[model samples]
Target: MKSYKKIAVVLTTLGVIGVSGCKKILDQSPKANVTPDVLASAGGVVGGITGVYSDLRNLWGTEGFLYYTNLGVDETLAGGGASNGGVAFATYKNYTNNVSDVYNALGGVFNIAYQDINTLNGVLQYGVAAFPDAPTRTAYLAQAKFLRALYYFHLVQTFGSVPLHTTFINTATLSDSRAPVADVYNQIIKDLTEASAELQNKPGENGSPFAGHAATKASALYLLSKAYLTRGWSSAAQSGDFQSALTTAQTLISTKATYGVDLYQNYADAYAPANDATNKEDLFAIEHSTDTKYGDFTPGASGGKINGWAYFFRPNYPTVNANYPASGGSGVMTRDIANGRPFFRVRPNYDYVNNVAFADRSNDYRYWNTFQTTWIANTANITTPRGSLTVGTDTAIWMPPYDPGADKRASFKGVIFLPPSVAAATTGANASTNTFFPALKKFDDPNRPSVNDPSSRPVVLFRFSEIYLIAAEAAYKLNDLTTAANMINVLRTRAAYRTTGMPANAVANMQITPAQVTLDFILDERTRELYGESLRWWDLTRTQSLIRRVKLYNAEAAPNIQDFMTLRPIPQTEINLVTQGPPIPQNPGF
Candidate 1:
């Protein structure tokens, strides 16, 4: 076991939380190591305890969240939208469910959450009594509980009733079984409520642009509302849960004191690469800096760029920043719906692409955010840049052979970081080769350092916009279609204009008729509003749309998709250490 040797001082209520409270405590001290003795000093304990959040940064791995968010959502499909068809996306679609048929990626939601619980338990076990200053130490406890709540939130959504391990268990006896969904939800509710109370007005770190700092009261309430909304709709929450959800969410939103935030007219500005937090629209994000994320953390083969390497990359297609003077990426959006239920029908008929009245552009104020012109190895296909985005040009492609861990071959990291071969593919005065595919325009940052700088940028984990979507969905679920439609307009109007191929009176006429506000409509609305973010799969599960959508939307690949896949199975490998009994049964239908 690794010894976390730097704990400075115990920063809790000045009393040692008995070890009996937890099955185990971290070995804060080691022979030759300056163990985190801080458990004794209030300040040192807080600092030492902060290590509990170490897993947050791991969410952006190649096989992790950086790509999963897009797969989970309906905003964009892996293959239909890109050339490689989002090769990494198979793990995300609904058809695969929990099974050994597929190899486990870095992000096993169950394992990750359990590990986090263990981390929190360690801090709570050693630091609560061990903190030097009880008040300061208590804040850490709140923060720890808050984090635990977030982890469980992700868990229950994905797996339904995950093995809710509250106390730290020794790996030797990690035989804990699954907890009922209700039990999991109850614990989550308890944790968030307490954390919000203690951390009241204590907003997360304004210093980091990313989600590094802790969440604020708004964050907690936002979560509370989502939890209630999910439960209220679930078979378990048939009673007054919906009303309770509304009240909790409303209370948090009502507090405009710290709730109000700036919204950037230019979407491209949101992902700029100044290696700093410059966007005013950001409510909360994990701030990354060069020092905080280096080597493997950088955006290269060795240090992949999961941070900037994100969802909705405009690949070098449809010509965003046609004047970008660099190699572009692939993955384009097609104008015609690729023959599917919602994908083909929802986009405005035609003439809406350039309509200034509804929605004009998807990028920022900079002209480059729109289109980048470049000659590539395969540049002959141009039917219409309208609905047809360049194949995988808009998606963020990385340097394939760069990272041995990922073992990607011939990958293009970014427009600016191309190697001699890839860069040579782009037509420069002396360059004869052409690297194809229009790169994604959304993740573009004019301030990026030559594409390889291990720089940190602020990334939103949760934002005010999500609040609006949640409200809209919740209202729709409560049978208030009018309210849902009204709220939905708030996001749509911002994304489009009257001229954007919509009914001339689109917004004015835009109403989710009570007849039209089915679970599907709400699902589509969620997709449009929160595309490319990691909320899709969870949203699908909560709404009971996973299996249906998976079979329908992914019919083309259904032959390869396993039908029994619904919930993920406990990684037999990870759970084999359990002394509880024979291996736990896999989630039903998985």
Candidate 2:
């Protein structure tokens, strides 16, 4: 409902201001009002597009979006320090259709998405006259359409059958109706198809005047492949949906060099903070920086614009002494920026951490690379119950991949946290208890201003490696096991350990044969490759595995997850605002 009011203000008062530097294209300020006549100029068009990019920060790295995409799934649980705001989503307890009953985060996404969709509509419609050059106009329009499709894709995947709005709304409108799921997918596919044709091969190609972080032809193709893949699993599925998805993904994979995107040689290198901006594996990313003007969060501001990715997945490492006392001293490993700020909104599921993704720990280096297994002492020399510990030389806390027996653990100088299974059995802690599991290392930002500050790192939304998984899944659905195995092997091979002492055939040990390809394998492979990237919920839902998977692997959500929960309830506020035409109906069973 707020979108209606916000849309009006943005269309009437939003202005065009110039900016410079690397991310200057997205650094525009909406300070002065631009009338309809002025909106036909080049500055106005670029500024409008920049506004659309700014809106992405609202969904990509924020807490609400993080919770919506990652929680209540098989891979995660609500952490010990999780706020009450996200409890309903994590536990599936008291989850109602009312926006106020659950936290406003879910509804906030709907509102923000629609607001941006409307703004993009205006940009596409009015900005046409802004560019007289053929290629320039087409590229601008392509960017807008690509973003519009992406917003709708999120809406459709989350809420299902969301109201399809293609035209700009300059005035308040009280009437809106949800379109059929098929029609919404049709529009998404159409927009992506056009965008794929018009967009540049790469972002800022050939020194062309394009936003450094703008969507490109590869981004469009990647999304288009996903659209077709998702449609293949829906009621709107056509005979060629799977084949089309496979074809499109293969095209992106085959022409990766042409699109200026490719998988990183090592999975660890792909997520290193140093490579955040220049990672070739990233097909599209939402940009954030240390500069307060361009980054989401202000330097010392409390909570306005910040990326919570660095904080949310973290465990309470600072309190490790309380749960598993350090042999040396309490201050052995205090909180630091290198260890990440532990907001503890969500933690990995025990099943996901120990038994599933990292089962092959020796052969797959991702197990060690993906998590911080050891905490080195940050304090000076101190003597305690067991031994003397020195800074940077001794281990303060060690969370081994597998449980070392009680005798083996006690022999170690520092505290040794057992595997989740052993720890749960010994301490009577459940999966949601957050008993100092290894923190996810992918989002850790050591360069943050302070231990408590949110990260300024750009969130990589889509990667070139995902295209292989998409193609593999589509291939499996189409009964092409050979292609599926081959596609998966590409990532699996890359994930193999290449350490000095590792086996020479580590990569070969990681490869799977055609007979090993299956739906479950693909899902598990996705977890191995893309966990905590905000795609698990959508992946399971697309495959109709959410209810089953949650019940099987997630103890917190098992009891309450129902078949009808796949589609989130349409926010009651939006339904209540419909004073004209027939009222919108909420999703069934909400």
Candidate 3:
């Protein structure tokens, strides 16, 4: 096995976070030795703590675990169409207990999590003593503790009863056992509560292009509140966890100005590529940059481009380099680098667009702001063999899955041939072959240095709107229906488009009453508000609604829905690597 000292040398050489113009938290000088004594210096402590954060970005950015967390939920489904056939990610869309694939797929999630936790453990043990001033030492320790808690939160949520490594045990040991779920949540709460007390309440310096990009009092508090809500629903939960969640959320709302966070008035502005720095809605986000040379935490990857989320959600159409007029028609469909290279990993469930989006709601800008239903061809020159000879007739590709009468092809006058239902628009004999589901255009990067590759859009980890939802849910759970309705109305009213009209987004007619504050209503509201935001699977799992929701919406995941499937199987490779003590057991079913 490789020595821990060797690993430390490599990590030190990598420097800390690659964010430019940020505070100098890393020591640039080459280190000959990285013992605990050497890390006792202030610079060393900063560098060590920054290294833990770098590990977090690497893990969250490219890790399959991040993708896995979004899979097989009610709101989203796998890419099962012809385009994404035979892909590795396509297989993971549905749940599987294949130990070997599970091991290989989540190696980064498991390994990097421990790597980050262990790094924080080192900083906690050695760095605290390194700082001479009490305030500085407390601040540094607070950041480390906050991050450690965040990482463990992900671990416990993904793989239940994960091994809790709180200290830096220099010597390798194989006897580590799985900590209880309640114990893991306890550690998370402890870390976040302690960190919130020490860290500044306001957002950090202009570290990246967005607010909430760094650890702060607000971020710690937000996560602590969420952790409490999660723990409150568990089998070994405490009595007042719900009350604690409600109180924390209430405190954040009342002190929003002190925290310098608020929901953006316009939903689209929150994700606009040009407005990241000005948007105050983001509570926590992973910062990426335009410079590829700064390097990435993930091994062998080199781009600051924001390709992962965009490409995964892009539409695979018009085969590469197929010019516009020849691809569809002049007025209908066209493809360009701006359209993105789609692998179709996560697509919207059929009903997500129809039943939820257009069922009765009107002027809900979220549907239009969050998704791309129309595609315009970038190129005009008909370079390839002009398959369908119609120029200037078809302009764009529109997949109105809800509109049964949408045209698949353009005729002489650009007339649409409407189908009777959504199934007719997407499937069977008359369905258009171009029936690629609506791509999540929120993360689309038109400013990427390279069009075909990834772009550097900051991944939002938490936003202020969620705090409202959290408060609402907590209040409802506590039987304070009035508070719950008021909390939810904030978002509902924000969603409204018209002051006085028949059909308006979240208008008075659309508002729910205190009696309507049910768990199902909250779930639906979350789905509408936070769709494709990487929080769905965990949300369902915590509520114990995974089986029911998946069965109701996803045909593919329903049959495989075993109760034990709620918790992921422990990767077998991890257990196999334990050469010294009792073996780690796999999750119940697998």
Index of the highest-TM-score prediction: 2
lDDT sort, best first: 2, 3, 1
Give each model's whole-structure lDDT.
0.47, 0.78, 0.65
TM-score of 3: 0.85
What 10-residue stretch in candidate 2 is worst by lDDT?
A: 11-20
Better of 1 and 3 by TM-score: 3
lDDT of 1 by residue, 423-480 (tens): 3544431111112322333334344343433224445677655666677677776777
**Mind giving the per-residue lDDT tens digits that candidate 3 earns over 350-401?**
5544575334446455676667765554445433333432354443345554
**Most lDDT-accurate candidate:** 2
Q: Candidate 3: lDDT over CA atoms?
A: 0.65
Q: Write the per-residue lDDT of candidate 2 for residues 1-590, one digit (tens) a residue.
A: 33364352232111112222224443334443434544567766666666667677777887777777888898888877765656777878777635353547777777778877876787787878887777777877888899999999998988888798887776768888889999999999999999998898976775546645668899999999999999999988989999999999999998988988887778988899888767888888877776655554676432444677887888777665523442333655778888878777787787765798678887888877777878888876544456767778888777776666666655567667666566677643212247467788898888988888878887788889999999999999999999999999999999985546677888989999999998889999998898889999999999999998898888889998888989877777777878888988888898
Estimated TM-score per prediction? 0.66, 0.93, 0.85
**Candidate 2 regions off by >4 Å?**
1-28, 31-35, 97-103, 300-302, 322-329, 381-384, 424-432
Candidate 1 TM-score to native? 0.66
